[model samples]
Target: MKKIINEMKVRLPSHSENEAVARTVVSAFSALIDPTVEELSDLRCAVSEAVTNCIVHAYRDLPEGEFGYIYISLRLYDNREITVEISDNGCGIEDIKRAREPFFTTSESDERCGMGFLVMESFTDRVSVKSKVGKGTSVLLRKIFSPHTSEEE
Candidate 1:
């Protein structure tokens, strides 16, 4: 069977729209993969973290009309692995290493847990981030799914 790639784009004001967007994106993938409840939750959490980062960190200084954009792409490989890419054209990370550190956050004023990257890494098979100080940021995540089965081989 041929692999399938699905993509979506969303423009949200900020945290207010985060949950809705995440749900919609994940639901789309669930339709094709039929992921278990736990798998679906993991996917939603990863996407939520990525989107939240874009909303809170990216475009931090821009005013209301400036806007924020999220581009999500999902690719399913033979019903085994799913690749998700979330890209934002906003103020990129100056130091990805620092950003990924557990409990280390630049948003001290906002009381953020700073566990976004860590959670994403823990749930996905592979996680990669590419960014330029002033250009933008793109987070690529991949996860492999195995069907639930019980048998003695």
Candidate 2:
């Protein structure tokens, strides 16, 4: 059986500022579960990558100054499992497998290192990516809390 403790959905323009917005929302939502500082940091970093990818890669087709929207959903389970889903309606990844490979970035001119997926995977217990060319991409992240850091006994 699955019990949901809390859930929230946030939508924002795919801009740099909103990246912080997503991270803040996730951090605040996570605070309720008393995650360790490391866990919190990892969560924030993963969120940053996901949001950045939406902003940088997803809306590449849009004319300059025109931006798309990013949807972020967060769910907290009774068992202290946190799930974050970030989606973009911008250009989708044509090669999900190659994209997930470390250092595989399309934005070389922007100095992108292409480690977004790798970082997300490292921080979260599980990460899933779904994308369709010209449709969009959705990233789902899951992390289970274990009391081990300073924030927890």
Candidate 3:
């Protein structure tokens, strides 16, 4: 029985410092469902990747010292389901399909591994993306924890 428990929305600057803020907020929110340690870790890592992408890539074209915003929304369900939507208002991807491919970064620097979506997909139950070239991008990640059945076992 999936029912809405609560929902939270946060809007912060596209600064690196706020990445941890987003991750911590999701961790605390999901903790209400008593997720396993591994589940919490996976959720945090996935959120970190999504948020980091916004800070690093989303506003790369902004003029010096200019920064945009990163918006994150979290919804918790009675069935132990949590959906996180991370979005950015900045230059969007030109090729959504190719951008999702591993090691397909637009960055010229050697530091980028281009594994953001891969990490998100690997960690979450479902990963979705929406974007336009000049508008912005949104990545939605959903994770559902199984009902407790240890007593039956």
Candidate 4:
């Protein structure tokens, strides 16, 4: 079992405004490894996409003013590995495989590019999803920081 270096769990309202909140918290938590600017930017973008999914898709059915909650957890492990989990307890996804395909948005509008999973996968070493209809979905993302990567090569 890998020991945890540090961790935090937060429950935020699934609101468009909280996207920035999530990004801020993620940036601060990820600073421990002193990741390169590019690496940090990638992580932030991935988090944004995940959070937006929770707000846009998961809670889509909520009465206009009503809102669901988004759960976010950040963990740092002993081996320079960081894991971020974003979850929601709202209407869940019906299909995981098809939803992951590029340009596959369920939204009727053109706003959603259907690239959330791809973005997360591109920015992290691993990305996993779990969902149950009416039970919501959770996206887990893992990244291993390597500042010397450029120097070593």
Candidate 5:
């Protein structure tokens, strides 16, 4: 089993501004392992998409004056593998398979491209989502860097 080098978890309100908080925390955690510029960029984008999904879809059903919480965790292993887990205690997806299809969105507005999961999958090596209609949703993302990456600057 690989030992964990470092790990962090944060819980924030399901608000749009917290999306930046997720990116900042994940990027800072990744910096310790010396990821390449491209890798870091991908990590940031993936995290942003995941967090945005939680903000937009998870707690969407809350009453006008209330909001749920979003939980994000970052774990780094000795083998240079990173795992990111984002979960929300809000209205969950009714269909997992259908939700993952590219361009599939339930929002009525056209502004939503319905590519959040696709974007997350493109940047991460693995993506998994679990949810129940009323329990909430959880997204897990994993990516391993090449063995030859340079040390942190």
Candidate 6:
């Protein structure tokens, strides 16, 4: 088997648009891996949450003209592992530990459930976050793909 990596970038102005972009990117990658419908849905949801966090939380105060970019990289390794990395150049988290707590949202008015990180963690096999207060944030997610018996000869 061989490994391939593909990357795409999208500018996010708000949380709503992130969902659509996430769906599109995840669908494309899932197609490459030939994941089940359920798995594809899960991947989309997780990617959406990560992207939303960047738009809603990272660039919350930025002006309309100011935009945050999401870079997504998908890697398929020997048909055994699928790795996705989503990054953004925005306000970046000051404290990753506190932010990841379930229901711990910085925006009470927005009614954020704070479950984004939790959902991402639950859906993917591995989830990692790297950020600096003034720099940016990068989320790395990995999920191992096991070919179904039908897919194997």
Per-candidate count of clashing residue pairs (backbone under 3 Å): 0, 0, 0, 0, 0, 0
Candidate 2 per-residue lDDT over residues 62-129, each given as its tens digit: 99999999999999998889999999998999999999999999996697999999999999999999
Mark the 10 consecutive residues where model 1 has the least summed lDDT: 7-16
RMSD of 3: 2.1
Cα-based TM-score, every candidate: 0.85, 0.95, 0.93, 0.93, 0.94, 0.86
2 or 5, greater by lDDT: 2
Candidate 3 lDDT over 62-87, as tens digits, reads 98888999999999988789999999
lDDT of 1 by residue, 53-128 (tens): 8888986767866676777777777756787788888899988999999998888669799999999998877899
Model 2, residue 52: what's the lDDT? 98
Which prediction has more favorable lDDT, 1 or 3?
3
Query: RMSD in angstroms, all models?
Result: 3.2, 1.8, 2.1, 2.3, 1.8, 2.7
Q: What pairs collide in candidate 3?
A: none
Write model 6 residue lDDT over 12-65, tens digit each, in one string. 455566668677967886676577777777778888888888778877778877
- Global Cα lDDT for candidate 1: 0.78
Task: Give the lowest summed-lDDT range of ten residues in model 3.
Answer: 144-153
Write down the lDDT that model 2 would get. Answer: 0.93
Predicted model with the maximum TM-score: 2
TM-score of 1: 0.85
Off by over 4 Å in 4: 147-153
Quote the lDDT for 106 in model 2. Answer: 97
Off by over 4 Å in 3: 149-153
